[model samples]
Target: MSIERIISRQYEIANGISNDIGLPKFKKYAMCNLRGGIGKTTLAFNLSYLTNDLLAVDTCPQGNLSYFFDNQYYSSQAPTVRDLILPYLVPGLGKATRVASYVGATNEYFADKNVYYIPSTEELYLLPSQLITAINQALGLQGAQKEQSLKSILYSLKEEIDREMEQNQLERCLIDTSPFFAGATQLAWYAADALVIPVRTDQQSVKSLELLINTLTSPQSEFRKYLPTNDLKVPQIQMVVLTHCGWSTVSGARNEPNQQTKVYLKKVFDILSRHRTLLSTGDPSNHLFMLDDFLGSGRISSVESKPLSLLHSGETKVIDRVRVSVNKSVDKCKHQLQYINQQLWG
Candidate 1:
């Protein structure tokens, strides 16, 4: 399809949206790892906000990704991912508009970028029992039914957005999950088309990556063992992102990663190479994407200035300087975003 046609289709969905049909199934990817503090949420925020035609779902109780795009959602009583899946759990309770209803628009930096996000809140932590019940109810005698439950709920959420919105414009779904694999995160995995794991260049992160690979690929891994039947499958990992590489100094000198980080990166590279046939990115080098600390610095998003903006309001020179700095940082992330796009659609 031509870009114009694709945009027109997305615009049509956005314009006629009211509770409706699932047009095209958006490519769904779960951004996760078994460990936290690996910049998963931050990466999610950047990818969702910077990229067009993407929907971000925050399943972590932390709600960091929600707050990243707009701090207002932190305390807002808006419905959340937990709310969206609530009805499915309690069979008799009609599915409420919890998740879809709470979807919010991005602010100025990403203004009207054709992006929508389902925020999260601490309240999600208390809903494990409800999720388990819903899972059990959704799962019939077959393991495939278990997986179907995940897809059905998410698809319903997507279709609901299609019906209620100005346009059901979501083309790609980026899900940010908690470290655990049992509850909401597990459901996110089942509903997704692929996985994007963000791992720091550290030994612990490397170990976590190894464990995640096993869980997704090994037949006897915990994920498969717990799925009730042998037929239930997990999404293939799209790629592993390496974040927090050595920071680039103000003087424009880039620091070197520590020896340990180099060792771990090599180890991860080797592991991905060994599993090339199973990975979306066949080459180890292609699968391991790197992001430097400079790109993640807060200079671009500092809140010391106006509340609704990312730019400074000082003199024109100051504003020009800020713009240059921000654009540079954005440019630095282009490769990362491009790689993510390829993994999602390629």
Candidate 2:
């Protein structure tokens, strides 16, 4: 398909993902930047879990949504998001589930559902290499086509989501993506109709935001051709730049935050607005715009939980997610969704 086709197709996919699948009416895009430690995984996990538990009532025997919390989420035979989901994308018995949710207890097909997880594992750390190899294979002299290989992955996700809604009552599919750019980031952006970018009000995140804009707008960037979707409506890009604001510095703090952090934060918001405007195709008044999710102002925070790796606590304490001085981060995430609806559909 042409780049325009790919980009426009995302809107159709969004319609399928939302109303067809029974998800929140407004949500269609996703956030899966390659930046690390920006809580991408956390956001994915939390979103999927919440959507499954809250949005849709009917589930499979294995609970396609529930498996994300478990350690043995994917089978060894089919690793990575593409591996587990690709097989079931086309017409098949369990293709209804769309993504591979879980193997039956006997390692057979699902009892009766079509939802699969893009598994996360230590071995999956090899996904980047696997993706590179696949890309190479795609463009060979007698090539299968690199674009199709990537497009297939997106189809796998959308198809499973659509299928599951057919059989069971599957509303939303929250895909947790690997951190950092590689093939995975491309897949997520291509699949997503919109994107939610959560940024901490720190220097590192601010710098990363500028870099992301360059990547998105670059001529060589793969996402450009697909923008503006089919009718040139929906713009095919939704961004939510959240301030990971909280307070809880440390035991002892010598000084307040530096001026550099503030400058960088403003720059991020400015660029974010401009990016939203571009994404909206300079409509002066278009719904495809960026919003801020600020639970509270900035503050240092503590992290008392273990690493998501679930590494055992040793002599020193491990941090699962950072503890924010603000008690409303969770609420903030929720509130932004409402804003998303207002902006996208209202």
Candidate 3:
């Protein structure tokens, strides 16, 4: 499909979804992509601001999403996502824990908007082995029993978060994951109702999409191999957002994805076409969206822990003792994000 047609279909779907007065179909979404540098963290941070009652969860040990909400937060901080998992690591220590105990309020910028998040710590890097040891020692059993036990521990966190959302009256939850498909990333997938996978306009990013599909859908793949039954449901692909797309002016007035972007986009569509069963819509165009490259504005937003919607053109800020201007690109980025939010939950 052409980029213009895809945008039109997305807008049409967004309008229909936004007009509905009922609740959204999916309350939990995971921002997932096996490849890094595709703007997953940035999108998750910005989408959290689309509504006041949304909760953002940082499941990656790298903690980039947590840093975007609170730059001052350190790896040493208490009550991180690690705290939520520690209790379940030991068999007897497991108990009904409140998700609110680990959640922290966002920085001042997001605080007034009533946004909250569960932070992550680097210590989470040690969890996979620790979890494996705990599971092995608990029972001398091997194979499927071990896999089910591990998933039970990981999934308990999601159950607690659901209860917290209900008690606090939150509207939705967005989870940011690590690029690797193991550990916390697995937890995010097991917890999500749907997934928003971001792909950059590159051959490697396109390949990552196929890898993700295989891992989730192929019975021989690691994740699906253990859980062969539909009892542990795999999240459906809600959308595949093309990030950092190159754009060029067309007809002297409108801008559209440049030729290079179109080439890769065709490849993406070809791949998605073969896996229609994994998608939320039969028409791939309805599930595709693009965000033009806005590196200058994105850098400032990341450093300042602010969303593009709050940024303005002609704004200036000092970075490393040098003054930098926030140009009109900020507005373009904000418009793209707003449209995406409408398609997602409006």
Candidate 4:
């Protein structure tokens, strides 16, 4: 008969009606901060791995997150983020039959969970130009239609996700984007139901937080101007996470954060605390939280190199001392990540 009838028939065969198929609460989060060196990739990597049934989308041109999971797997002619996203801009590239085709599962990083990630490549750098044109064209559209352009393009994929979630396929979508708040970053923000901004305890981070807060609060900001009005509320569903707080002490005792870090931390806490209040009272959108995850100088996971989280030493020479240092550093980093998550969704 009709398409609607076909869908109804399929639902009947599945032993359930549309009403019985209660989809899980899907959460799309974008982890971003304008400042570089803030361990955004590292936080993204660990969080993605730790989260259950997650689809991690990497929008960074650096491809650091892709590298973490054996870049070869993601880079082996598989559909990259650019391939999937640009189709929306160009049109007529043939619909993505299986959206999961663009994703790659973790080889063996986590024993219990299989985290799928949308890989990025160096060629994604060319996206800025195409993205600008698409955004401009979207802006040119009239009335509410223009506002929905961004979100509408991703609607099919989101529907597929909802269907999968209804079938217990995946539970979450985590978006990891580049440092700049433009192009792909804007798309991630538009798609996210919530945001997790990872910040470092540094002067630049303080400034970045200020800028982020001001931009999201002000309707006149350029970032705010381009956001799809359909399902976008930047400030209400956002959380701030502090990373890389220095705790090193030469006296063989754990030390507090440096004075500069402490000062900036206080400033950030004050800013986010106010936003948290606004999000609670005015918006009442999900939950807003601030977390502290201390990461020292441990080597972060990358395609070319692995994490030092499992460092060992067979030699009895200086390697023994090196192992101790690496082990201690990794422990602190892992603890920080766990603490951040505990505060974020707990």
Among these predictions, the greatest lDDT belongs to 3
Question: Which is the leading candidate under TM-score?
Answer: 3
Model 1: residues with Cα > 4 Å off, grouped in runs: 1-26, 97-106, 133-167, 220-222, 226-233, 247-260, 299-346
Residue 123 displacement (Å), model 3: 1.3
lDDT of 3 by residue, 261-343 (tens): 87887888888888877777666766777786766677778888878788889887888887777877676677678767876
Question: lDDT tens string, model 2, 189-228?
Answer: 5544555566666667766766766666765654444232
Q: Give the alpha carbon lDDT tens digit for every residue of 1-346 in model 1.
A: 1122222222222223312222222377789899998878767776665466666788899887777766677668766776666666555666545244223344555665777777777877776666656545666546666676655553443444343333455567788999876667767776676788888878888888888888777778645654544435457667777776553244643333345555655676777777776565444554565555533133344332111123332312234346424444443444445445544554
- Candidate 1: lDDT of 2? 19
TM-score of each: 0.71, 0.54, 0.87, 0.73
Cα shift from native, residue 207, model 4 (Å):
0.9
Which of the two candidates, 1 or 3, achieves a greater TM-score against the reference? 3
Q: In terms of lDDT, which candidate is stronger, 1 or 4?
A: 1
- The whole-model C-alpha lDDT of candidate 4 against the native structure comes to 0.57
List the candidate numbers ranked by TM-score, top first: 3, 4, 1, 2
lDDT, candidate 4, 1-346, per-residue tens? 1122322322222222212222123377778888788878877777765567777777898887777765564446766666667777776776443334222344455445656666777776777677778778887888878877855553433443444444446767777888887667766765666667777777788788777777666777755666546465553444566565553354643334545555655666666556664342332122222223422223424422344333332211233244212334444455445544543443
Error of 1 at 155 (Å): 8.7
Q: Model-by-model lDDT, in order?
A: 0.60, 0.40, 0.74, 0.57
Clashes of each: 11, 15, 1, 0
